[model samples]
Target: MNQDPLQNLRLSHPAHFLALGFGSGLSPVAPGTMGTLVTLPLVWLLAFSGQTGYLLVTLLACVAGVWICGRTARDMGVHDHGAIVWDEVAGMLLTMIAVPVNWLTLLVGFLLFRMLDIFKPWPISYLDKHVHGGAGIMADDILAGVVACGLLHLLIFIGWLPVPAL
Candidate 1:
């Protein structure tokens, strides 16, 4: 693509700032992973308020992300530019829902979410290919989060994944 993802930052658009994960997405390498890493602390902090608070924050983020991502992509004139990583933040937040916020669970959730996102299994792959615009940008990642969440819960149920006392 000829378009520079940084153009919005140069222009100082608020939507670009948020959609870029507050600059984490500007990383030259693995911006999405960087975005998730940046999001971890925010999620950790939110977790202190308990699950209800975490869920509320995550819901708000997801809702805001659709608009932010959409606007940033429009500004960049690119569809789901690699630099727009708010979707990663929302996905990671969704992945962590009810999964406990300890280091181990965070690590597992991150790995699982990244794998499902990268591989894009079945309907996730279908959505990634078929969907468009901001919702499309967010859809596959959200589904990956759902898949990761379910797997984490299953592991907990089987007693394979021990939930550490927070």
Candidate 2:
């Protein structure tokens, strides 16, 4: 525990500026997952506004998160360290894309996102291990979100999953 997470992860690097995710990576507990979880309130609140707001925010995060995550990672000198989790936040937000504003849908989306993220299958795993800097850390999670979102969308399209009441 004496090894500071920031020091060990090297979050001070200038290039990884965005990877720090506004310092969300500094959280004590499972920083990455927690950082991702931190967005739940905002996501839930915006859910009522329809998918447009959520979509807009998620998209914005995705675009911005890349730079943030990349900068922070470079500054820290760590390659895709767990502390850098803005990718998870963006990915989770992406997973919820098009999802109706409801507890059930949110819960399902969260589960799916977490599951896919943890698994990091196929392209996600490849990018996670192969890519470098902020793109490495965030890209894989974002891809995971894409996969989860596609699955969710497919379920909805086929009538397997009903849209929740907003």
Candidate 3:
């Protein structure tokens, strides 16, 4: 008899719960996207805390995610399993840093982050290939977020993407 692959990954486990993006990573399709979407509310909430607070929290999450993701992956006996999406959560948070919290900014940030993450351009692709372990799983997405953040900022600076008055 074959057991379900997810059977061993219990949501009851704190590491599993976090690493899986609070169950968003369990989605049957586009788990990474789902994980990123799940983090939107968090980004919205963090917006109120200002950029410094947002950066601190995102940094903490990324640091903790290394351990949370690594431990969960070890338990599941896989290397950077598709269902481990804490990296996505941290990446999305990084992408939204200092950007306005309005819907347009949120949507643009989401698309930019997701696009870079999916496409893995240049250095992002390099890190994805050369890096290993939990840090490896996270480095690429974080870089994608950084690049996306820069692009978004550029758009705002150029007046291509106007920052709506809050």
lDDT values, one for every candidate: 0.87, 0.74, 0.91
Clashing pairs in 1: none
Residue 46 Cα positional deviation in candidate 1, in Å, after optimal superposition: 1.2
Error of 1 at 20 (Å): 0.4
Candidate 2, run of 10 with poorest lDDT? 8-17
1 versus 3: better lDDT goes to: 3
User: How well does candidate 2 score on lDDT at residue 165?
Assistant: 46
Error of 1 at 146 (Å): 1.1
| Runs with alpha carbons beyond 4 Å of true place in candidate 2 | 1-24
- Against the correct fold, how does model 1 do in TM-score? 0.93
Mind giving the per-residue lDDT tens digits that candidate 1 earns over 106-161?
A: 89889998889888899999999998988899989888888898998898889988
The residue ranges of model 1 lying beyond 4 angstroms of the native Cα positions read 1-3, 10-12
Top TM-score prediction, candidate number:
3
Tell me model 2's lDDT, rounded to 2 decimals. 0.74
- Compare candidates 1 and 2 on TM-score and give the better one: 1
C-alpha root-mean-square deviation, each candidate: 1.7, 3.7, 1.4
Enumerate clash totals for all models, in the order shown.
0, 20, 0
The estimated TM-scores of all candidates read 0.93, 0.79, 0.95
